[model samples]
Target: MAPPATQFELAQPPNDAISALAFSPDSPSRLLASSWDKNVYLYDTLRNSEEGAHGTLLRTFEHRAPVLDVCFGRDGNEAFSAGMDWQVRRIDLESGEQTTLSKHAAPVRRVVYSKEHSLLISASWDSTLHVHDPTNPSLGPLAIPLPGKPHAIAASPSKLVVAMTSRLVHIYDLSALSASLSSHPDQQQQQPPQPWQQRESSLKFLTRAVAAMPSDAGYATSSIEGRVAVEWFDASAESQARKYAFKCHRTAQPQTDGGGSTATTDVVYPVNALAFHPVHGSTFASGGGDATVALWDAEAKRRMKVYQKFADSVAALAFSPDGRYLAVGVCPGFETGMEDYSGEGRTKIFVRELGENEALPKGKGK
Candidate 1:
């Protein structure tokens, strides 16, 4: 028999739109969520066992400005955040202490930790990337300059992928980055490292989110035009040919004109988030402004499942370490004509416990 299929809502969520959701590497129940409310909220997802509400608000780490992204450091007790204050912070979860690691010229967009490399990299809208050594504080971060401002970033076991504006994508070798940071511990003014591979984005519109595959074979990128492209890092013709893209998170609405003739309007929503399952690296999930979450089999080029629509746009997504739970962050989406916006009273977080084969790859696709 399969394990129980369950999904539950967390208690006492963030007061504003969630900018990012991250599950602790040490345990599946421990989660970290950074918000636009200038705080990072920690929760024990399994604190109260009986209620099935897989969370208890443990604490909140407030920042000087709205937090844009967050991720776990080497352990559960440590975390790092990127924020609108143009600073990257290191937070101690156990003591609720915060430390500023570095500052950027513009708002920081994303922060990611590479366990295998022991490096913490943060991307900012100022078109620069900062690489820090969490273990060695005396060493300052090695700054890397980019041609375009980064909108999303992800790290696999060996590679770092940065997606930026103007449809530019850069792939950097982690070993080179680690060595560069170690070589210049005290010199923050040292020259920036060049990208291992630089290529234009596959999608036509602006890039929205990027996620690296756990296996380190390749990475996936989503765009504002409701499309996702999967490509490899091998730089081989065979591997490059295997790369493909597909459309999702789109809907068509019927419109009526004065002549009583009805027409359909195709509405495209941005794919805001992308997450790969920790265990099954070939299978992944995509969340969108369409207010839905979808599971896809990259190897098969098939969609496994699309979860029920949430109350608002799906802004962020994450999978637990064991690949047992998938967390969804929902809030208001910033669209074309919106002059003002807020996630107040509309923000929510939901955790879905996966069944035995819920995210397995289903081979043989068209």
Candidate 2:
């Protein structure tokens, strides 16, 4: 049997459309959202303890324009936001202090940080990714060009990966990335004229190519094309090798639900946001436009359970560190399009546990 869809609405932002969202990685119950209303909100998931009391609103701040994305920085208490105004800003969750990093040439689409490196990455419509140090915004950004318009970006603290409109992913080594920036003229004064700075540097492309994941990976990408494919290149290799891999694994079925009948003929969905249990890396959840959240055996590429029937496209998904809960943001009836995002939106938290029937039909562990 499938897992029951247990949900709880967290909070409703006063925005007509919520375009970007994030839950605290360190504390999955805490949430931050940005919307067309030009405001940013922070909410706690467990605030509704008493019927008479509401969840705590850590803080809310108005932006100058429609904010595109909001994300946690290296620290859980600090958030970063980018938007239509072509600017990126950082907010301190505890003090509610906002700081503008720098103005982009185009609207900002995404902002991410690598806590281990104290680095922040932002992508913009201008087809550039700016690498910045969140602790200090006064420094210039190390601008990296993209093959096409970047729709989404993800990183693992030390590396940067981006999905571009051309169905490709650009992988840049953070160490090399930081080295490239150090060679910039602005950084020359601090480096004392290094010999490498005198040599002409060129734009280096990854030896390997990664495919774009359509929808279901999260709110940042679309899946109308059938599936989003990603390929990664190992920069450490002498030949710059590439590897083809599925970022999200979806079982295909024939058109069902009046769409089809064969399991082999249907398209595979893309993965939207991914949440690995803070304590258990092998367990994670993926939410998407299909209105279904799936629990996967991340390391083994196996499906453990499916949680379905969400009101709308999933905006965000997270797993608590204790591996006991799942949280998701849903925008009901809005999957048809984002134009009607204001209809009804809600955040739900589900209590999850390992199924007891792990008893396999033919296995020694069983």
Candidate 3:
């Protein structure tokens, strides 16, 4: 069969503006999305029924305020959501039960689960990060203050990284988190199951970087108008917390009206949402507002491929666990008639197959 015009347009949302999206870990063929309609929707991307071609909406959960972000835990069993309601809630896929947490000063922008499956970290316009142990909902004062309102969060089992509107990303050392959690006299023995030991850190390092980054390279962030960034810190760095400074758009500005602002051109488009390839070290994808999805060769600091036909800003993106597919959440018509949905537009999830030797058209004959 001839190669299709596009990889695949798996699903289109019910409403025009979709705000948040996630692909199920247990079953990648499934997806979850939230929208400006104050509702959460799930879809089976692989489903082919007479009802429609876009797939079916499995369930819809309503929020008092619009649902801005949605994320699935390690498996597909549960999902965490945060939105304009200033709240973070977890929904059990099987039970369909919802649990609400504290309110943020501003909109809760994102939610992610740490590796242990015990804690959920949320970033909000509130300028603070809340770490919650869903197992113990009554615990309080678990908030971590940030220099500015945070807009995104990424977490592994032992580390939590947050991206702020200030164009900085903060890394929290979770190796000692268990120690902190066990501080209470009555909870001394109830420590978290695993710690971020050097072994774990080394494993995370070997798995993430194609080549190991410098030990003193330090963990800082790169951003455009300080919108979002990715950072990595050496756990061995002194003043671990304060040593969280890495890099940025040394010279860039905010293009006010899309006149190809020097700032927009200078930024290489910092990664909006980051994810490791299910298979390769030093292989990752960065999705952002550039209307381009860039694949990176981390070790070589090289560009592998850029998918530029999205026609809008990209909000949520992911690599399938097996690394065979790339899913991007983008608003329709962003360049001409489409406005950025910020996870809130008529977004569609496009599944592109990897390893296409001819991803780009060749320059007529050699």
Model 2 agreement with the true structure over 216-326: per-residue lDDT tens digits: 121122233223222223334541333223333344665545655544654444445555544444445667656677665433445666775576556566555444456
- What is candidate 2's TM-score against the reference? 0.72
Steric clash pairs (candidate 1): 45-54
Q: Pick the candidate with the highest lDDT.
A: 1
Report residue 20 deviation for candidate 2 (angstroms).
3.7
Candidate 1's residue-wise lDDT over 1-366, tens digit each? Answer: 787779888888888889999999989999999999999999898786465555798999999999999999999999999999999999999998888899999999999999999999999999899999999876878889899999999999999999999999999999999999988745556667889999999999999999999999999999999999999999999999999999999999999999999999889999999999999999999999999999998888989999998989999999999999999999988864566777888899999999988888876232
Write the residue-wise lDDT of candidate 3 on 193-305 in tens digits: 23222111211111111111122232223333312222345454543433222222123556666565444435533334455564564465666656667665543444567
Task: State model 3's lDDT.
Answer: 0.57
Displacement of the residue 6 alpha carbon in candidate 2, Å:
6.3
- TM-score of every candidate relative to the true structure: 0.95, 0.72, 0.70
Give the candidate number with the greatest TM-score.
1
Model 1 — TM-score against the truth?
Answer: 0.95
Q: Which stretches of candidate 2 lie over 4 Å from their true place?
A: 1-7, 25-28, 49-54, 182-222, 226-271, 321-324, 332-366
Number of the candidate with higher TM-score, 1 or 2: 1
